[model samples]
Target: MGANFNLKTLTVALAALSAASIASAAGLDRSGQDITAFLQDGVYAEAVYTYLDADVSGYDNAYVGADKNAYQQGNKIDDIAESYDFFRYGVKADINDTFSVGVLYDEPFGAAADYSGDNNFVAQGDRDATINAISGGEVKDFASAANIVGKIQDKVENGGTLTAIEQAQLKKLGPAVAVAQADYNMEGEGTNVEVRTENITAILGAKFGENKEFQVYGGPVAQRVQADVKLRGTAYQAANGYTMNINAGQDYGWLAGIAYSKPEIALKAALTYRSEIDHNLNVSEIFPALAGAIPAAATGMNGEIDITTPKSVNFDFQTGINPTMLATAKVRWVPWSDFEIVPPLYNTGSKADPTNGPDGLSLVSYDKDQWLVELGLAKRLTPALAVTGNIGWDSGAGNPVTSLGPIEGYYSAGLGAKYNLTENWAISAGGKYLWFGDAKGQIPNKFAVSNFEDNDGFALGVKLSYQAKQNFN
Candidate 1:
């Protein structure tokens, strides 16, 4: 029993490590464009390198306490605490002094979680029960354990026959089995819950007046999104279980934004707005060996998943209090309500019948509209060097419910420095820390359960640039 416990602990740790590695491998968006006014000029070209690291810890009770064989061990999972790093490079240039264009290449979104493996710490009976539920009896000879347990419970409630030994076993195994099954189904048959998105955007800005005090900028933006979705564990049969590998596809989308800034009166303010984009993704499924039971309708499953990324508006203001001192403030409004994931052409009839069809139809939804505020101060230490520090707060989305999303609100603080290597060249480096708030969600099953947790992380960034002397009148 002691050896068993040790092995179980090790298994859980491995599982958690695998999950964290998966989550961090995608290397999505780590930092936004620098808010410094000096980099906004049309005649300069800049390149930036950013590193983002995060430690995510949370429980997903989406199916908690639902299965007869499910168990809960403090809602702790193996791969909850993980870290990720991202690297990005971008370039901006001025064309003919009136038009400015820039391009950015980076990973914008990614997710990773793993629960299917032989080393899983869950007990054999509990794992088997959850697998049966998710496989939908696709496996032969499994006896549909969940169904059997449900029937047994119903019989007991109605005063059915049960020997003393049977009664004792049921009482001893019920809760643990149920919780373990819930965890298994969640790790195996639950939603793929992971995503990886890579995006590239091109921007253009223009100045109207010769003095260049006033300007208007807008441009077309395009992105290519790739999604790798996994099938739930319950969808697989043990003897001849169905195996669905990662589903990957690319979609094209576009956006546009406009901004204006003025810098003469020791005061500057700019407003920018961006639009949303949509993706129609195509998905395919692969079957496992020995399951020759492919129905005629299963020949070539083709479908689309619609995704609308969010849009946002940004406001930035700055003032010079002294020759070498400056203060700045920024605010952003993001339309989270518009965020949604809708699968195309769901078979409602098939979903209604668990015995003869696929998993039920469901869509990904979130109430995520939010606001971000930031304040910073900068000081020029010498003719060739300057440093700045800032703090920021992000309000939680009105509705903070998600199966795999870890936290809702965040607090961040950062420091940055710039050094002029030459009259026309400069370099900058910075780092930031983020604190995330806890979040909770429920899993739909016979037993409605809840899961909650929190997360946090840090980010580092560097920039290199070359600038031309200002052609001021």
Candidate 2:
């Protein structure tokens, strides 16, 4: 029975691995080639974990906020999103004196959790009232202008109305109402998504003439992916007028690259480019008991949503400054502008057939393009020990962003060390600190509310490796 249980666990693990590969291929970005190469150098197996925190505050009414609210509040919401963690394991094998292969399992790209509460209400008061009136009322004449007036009248009677004595008072009241409506919309509340990928890469490398100062390698790569997405909170529930279930999918993709290294000058550089993958996801639009409250036309399927992962480029270089010190630098570019996930028929430019989803709403394009830069230095403490530190910066994507994900840029610092345990064994450890910058978006005439705050976090990693007894011939 114990053996059977072990086998069952192994089977489940394999299935999960397969699903992760597919999901990675469909929507993930694999651009940390240098880091992967460092892990593939053989002589050891390593594990690394990373955590990042972002505080996105400020309201400009030019973009979407956590609550899907269109108004802005003077005091931004202090949103604490779900934390991020990743694990990686790798091994290297020599096919001959000049050829070798490496395999790795890790999460290259993933995102989960968004803002919560009625944060958006500070920005989208009018829109929220409009929607509630259309959906909550017995006479659902959404297209009739008279219905809007009736809703306002209802609000006035219910003491939800705004009263002003002069232009200044009216101005203040208008923004206040807008903010309330925005909160009522609450589109991004309790939204969470997770994606993981497992990769297998093969490489053939060769050393050049005399001193073995130069070496080059190239390989073909494949990956699988798995993903899960969930929507919660009052905003989503209120907007749907029904309870909703989590949505999920699985997919796959491939990668390839070549690298060169020189030991004489203590310099190494490599370039890697990953291709994009697409997923034909099977998504479900779950409905809760409140679903019965909305009209049947607004309660069902929004059709198929297409999620296309983005592609990226990575470049890394490192060199020794002297016998006791070394420096390393890296850069990454991602074309987020092309990133889009549109539910079919919803935003197809036709308003007559409202069959796609509520009010023909869609995810549309993200229109983001960004870059990151990193620099590090290492010092040799002894023949068997070394220590290193690094700092990095990420540029912000363009304004008028459309994706639900918040935040602009990040600043990070980290430390790492290596120690020789014995003649054939060694150990490595690393830690990082990340600081997130503020981000702002617009919600029209409503109040502007920041979704998060300026925040920071740390990461820890360790690796163990053993030198082979003899080189394979």
Candidate 3:
């Protein structure tokens, strides 16, 4: 038999490692939806802060002709993945031996990426190139027609009459002038996007069975979400200069879970499920390049964008390997394939165009579900010190994913340490390094726009926690 050691005293030592888990997986997943704070044996509270940074650089595709049958590697895209940070807090208390309540707060989903190099994602601002590209190399003839139409329009607006030749030119120019004007307004910043979501969960747990070893918990969750997007450069072709603003919207969802624990051996296991949340938010969209085809798109349109965040399930388990060591495993699954964001005006304008057909397109979507798993071990080296190590793998949503958030999935390794400040308080810190998978960035119509390879990122986190054990003596 192994040496006799009370494992309950070391339960909180390595738990802080959850704070360092990076969120750069597919489909805007963040926070990992951790609920371990609610599983503590007593009154517990914690505050955690995490920072993540990714280096995602790639090459844009350069295609000639309208058919886009062939392409060559174009300009080098600089690192577009931006560094970001967020916070999490949780507090739980045992109402009695058989009842407990808790509240958890975290930013569960988000994205931050911006393109700034001289790549195709950046604005070229060349009038001739813009017209030539849109007109299939008919710059000379198209410019002449646009000039004639412009002169006649100036005269009419200035209280002057057009010559017979100018009137004929105006009639012949027709839609070309509108197209040219729309192209001229396309000069702006490069492609960029930022999305954010927050979740606050309130839970109530009931313990039952002999010795109260089993528990069932459930609660309501309130979520808030918002986003901003801008599309630029010739890489997007006719859809360049598009922009969207999604106002923040708040909604409600739910979470349910069951847990089993054996305190003598420090064994605890929990399976949690979170329902999907739908947000009907007001959005503003501008797609000037489509003005000639859908005149209403030039000025901009305001409508509702329906976004459904994916449902997810998480499993957390830990058991004592010996008196001074513990082993842990975590598994998570998210149905990213069922998630999508569709802005009303943008989809309508896309459908109105002959190329997009009747069904139109979603602003963003994933091709597959996501699965993640992590395994770890912890060792208490001293009475007040503990260390932990973990390795993880994530199966991304899919390759050829949306350009806005281009990373597929990642492999990661991490290390953490905790030091007790007193019997009831402790501080923990950890860091993780990630190796990202190669991917092809795509747009709504399944068009590959860029390629990313050999990228990596890192994450850092710190947590402070307090706990007071319940007395059964």
* lDDT score, candidate 2, position 81: 49
Best by TM-score: 3
lDDT for 448 (candidate 1): 17
Report backbone clashes per prediction.
20, 56, 0
In the range 1-473, model 3's lDDT, one tens digit per residue, is: 55554665557555656767656487899889899999988999999999998999999877645554344688899999989999999999998899999999999999899998777777666555555554545444556666766777888899998788776555435344444455456555788999999999999999999989999999999999999998877666556677899999999999999999887888899999999998889999887755655676778788888888989999999988888888889999999999988888768756744667788988899999999999888888887888889999999999889989888899999999888889889999999999999988887877778899999999999999998988655
User: Model 1 segments beyond 4 Å from truth?
Assistant: 1-39, 59-73, 78-82, 112-128, 131-194, 231-260, 285-302, 344-363, 398-400, 443-450, 470-473
Better of 1 and 3 by lDDT: 3
| Predicted structure 3, TM vs. truth | 0.90
Task: Please write out the lDDT profile of model 2 over residues 12-73, one tens digit for every residue.
Answer: 11111111111110123322433443323334344444444434434322233333455444
In order, the Cα lDDT scores of the candidates are 0.47, 0.46, 0.82
Instruction: Tell me the deviation in Å of residue 296 in model 1.
Output: 8.5
For all predicted structures, in order, the TM-scores are 0.67, 0.66, 0.90
Name the candidate that leads on lDDT: 3
lDDT of 1 by residue, 1-473 (tens): 11112211111111111111111111121233222222255445555555556665444232322253343433443343234455444566667556667666555455544433321222233465554344333322233444555666788899999877656435433432343344443443433445555666666667666665455655555555555443333312221122222255454544344344444324556676656667666654332221123332123345556666666566766665555666777777766666755443222322433743366533344566667777777667776777777777776554244434434657877777777778667777777777766555322212212244556777676667666644533
Instruction: Give, for candidate 1, the lowest lDDT window spanning 10 residues.
Output: 13-22
RMSD of each: 13.9, 12.0, 4.3
